[model samples]
Target: MHDAPGLVAILAYDGLCTFEFGIAIEIFALPRPEFDFAWYRHSIVAVDRGPLRATGGFMVSADAGYEALTEARTIVIPGWRSRDELPPHALLDALRQAHERGARLLSICSGVFVLAAAGLLDGKRATTHWRYCDELARRFPAILVDPAVLYVDSGQVITSAGSAAGIDACLHLVERDFGAHVSNTVARRLVMAPLRAGGQAQFIAAPVAQVPRHDLAAVLEWARERLGETLTVPQMAAKALMSERTFLRRFKDATGMTPKAWLQHERMARARSLLETSALDTEQVAQRCGFASAESFRVAFRKAVGLAPSFYRERFGARQR
Candidate 1:
């Protein structure tokens, strides 16, 4: 482990998303006896410990109160029920104290609203779910909200776009604290993809396709099976039976990426899987993933993931006997 495991406290408020809370619990609280490394000590601290109703009518109880914030090395706000409603004054004060003591703060989805209400996000680059980006900006004009990326890490504060993005942000935290290898191991055990290529734009909804338009979904599936092949846009267009122009437009509307960009992402994703699950040399892995050489794969992988291929493998690859 790079650093000793820290105390992690998740704020449980009324009307929390149980899924988001579970994401934090699963990543930080779950046992990982395989690594023989220290793990975070977690707690569910309520603003008030009464019976609280989570999202979808699930009931939960917290073991501690807002005071728990004072001792936590990292504080996570899963989500807030209403953006317009202000967080409790006592809770805000505790958060402020936590910040003063240098605790790392994070928010998932609409939880950004709570941090904004506490005046913690003013003049800082932050993000929330795309659906709430405009309002989050309108309500807090001082904050810089980028709706494109999956998450933003601004030193002490971090925020994620939506539900599953919370996993991305949390995994990133593990990477920051321990190393990529530990984070990758945790991701594998949880059965989650090690990383998602591209930005939230890929997942954002777009205008409906014209009725006469050829479906690009089938072409995308076909391309996945041929990632190791030298596939091109014209080839994909042919599979969809459309001219390049119509194929490109429809592909973007459907998947929020150009055909070429999507193919690169697919290839890089396959590369990561090989690095994590196989012992093949980088050159062999590059060939299996359709890259011309290890050098070319390294450039593309770094551009896509912000890390070198060998570094990624070192973190996520199966341990040697």
Candidate 2:
């Protein structure tokens, strides 16, 4: 089997998208003199062996072709143009071959359809752009299409939601290949949030909650300001001038998660922020995040981030310190 941290090939095609394409290059192909070890040797590969005409009346060409996908350690298919159009059989074979040889595969947005077309997503839980979730589910019934999450990593293959969510997936890959410290470095260079708090569902349209409700909005802001406090559903309901049952139903409708789940997500995000930006001890961080104890924080952080709080802090803490 091929070893980790090697060449990365991004598959391109006749129709190119600027955002996802730029994100791929920004994440994988950029020069990283900050790190002591060599970063990815990246190349853009033409799937059809021709110049590309992008959506915005632009022409582009690849540095290499499908042959690169065969040898690369990671193969990324940034947003494909259409889900209806299938990729070439040759490209499909190349992807399958790469996966067989232990190259990690990743897709952004509609690129999931290309992976799905190749049968790579047959039995995997994958995600696509929120707009195409239903179509992906209808077309590939076997693949569990999680429409709520920003991305899904099924070990060998990873899929992400539309457009900007691709950046999150790419950073996640960087974290996997290197570590949180490297990912944070890259994110800092990009001037973007290194991590996000909510899921794709939060961005999806909720007609009822789309407009501002003074009572609910006020309570939400209040709760956000006090993430360290033990904010219960009844307390929130009282703050919003609603019954507990009403608040529970409305909260889910508004935020697409129950109060408890939302609180946990906020706490997780706060913990991450603390881990990255502050030098607090694990117990202090846990207390600040409203976790019952440092042990509970460790358990929850491990479950959410796949790393212990202290270890995460060690890896992702701000370099300025």
Candidate 3:
């Protein structure tokens, strides 16, 4: 088991998103008797004065204030009250100091706005909910806003897309701190998938929430099954029985990514799975993922995952642990 990760401070304020706030509590604060080792120690820190109002017509009282952030190893910012509402100056200052002292800051949903307002996300790649991505970009031009991703893990600052994507980012942190085994166990308790790659698309064109386009679902499924093969836009378009131009537009509308980008994400996702679960060598994994060569795979994997395949395997592989 890994050493205990230090205190986690979850901020509470007026107009709180109860769901997002609850996510932090569930992942970090909940007692985990399943593990013999110590889990995260958490505290709710108040961003405003007494009797803060939250969503669903309830009030919350925090255990501490901004000062609690100082000793925290990690801080979670739940969905902000509004995109336009700037965070309190004191709260912003506290966050900046916490970050300067090397505390990891995790922002969920609209909470990215708070980080952006605090200038913590300057010159860094970040993502927020798709609806706010454009506004986030417009408001903070220095921040590289990725609308396609479920989350952006920029080392100290991790930002997640809307709502449930916060669960993915939190589980990812647990994996980083402990290991895949521990994270997967936690996921089982939560009844959720063990992990979702942060690079996975967020489906910006949410016609019916998460429902896929009927015309493209079959083609997408076929393409996913054939990730090891050389698939092209035209091939996908042909499979979908649409003209190239129409296919391209429809694909983006359905998936919020170009065919090539989607393919890369799928390949990388498969590569990550193989690295975590398989005994295959790097070259074999690369071949399975349709990379021309192991070297090409190494370059691409490092670029996309921020880690080499071997190192990733060593750190996350079930057998290695």
**How would you encode candidate 3's per-residue C-alpha lDDT over 79-180 as one tens digit per residue?**
999888878999999999999999999999999999999999999999988888899999899999998788889999999999898999999899778766
Candidate with maximal lDDT:
3
Per-residue lDDT value at 143 in model 1: 96
List CA RMSD, all candidates: 3.9, 3.9, 3.7
After TM-score superposition, the amount by which residue 314's alpha carbon in candidate 1 deviates from its true location, in angstroms, is 3.5
Encode model 1's per-residue lDDT on 160-235: one tens digit a residue.
9998889999998987676555677788998986666556776787666557677666877898888878998889
How does candidate 3 score on lDDT? 0.87
220-312 in candidate 2: lDDT tens per residue? 779888988889888999998888887887787667688888788878878887887877899999999898899999999999888888777
**Backbone clash count, each prediction separately:** 1, 0, 0
How do all models score by TM-score? 0.77, 0.82, 0.82
Q: How far is candidate 3 from the true structure (C-alpha RMSD, Å)?
A: 3.7
Candidate 1 at residue 51, lDDT? 78
lDDT of the structure predicted as candidate 1: 0.83
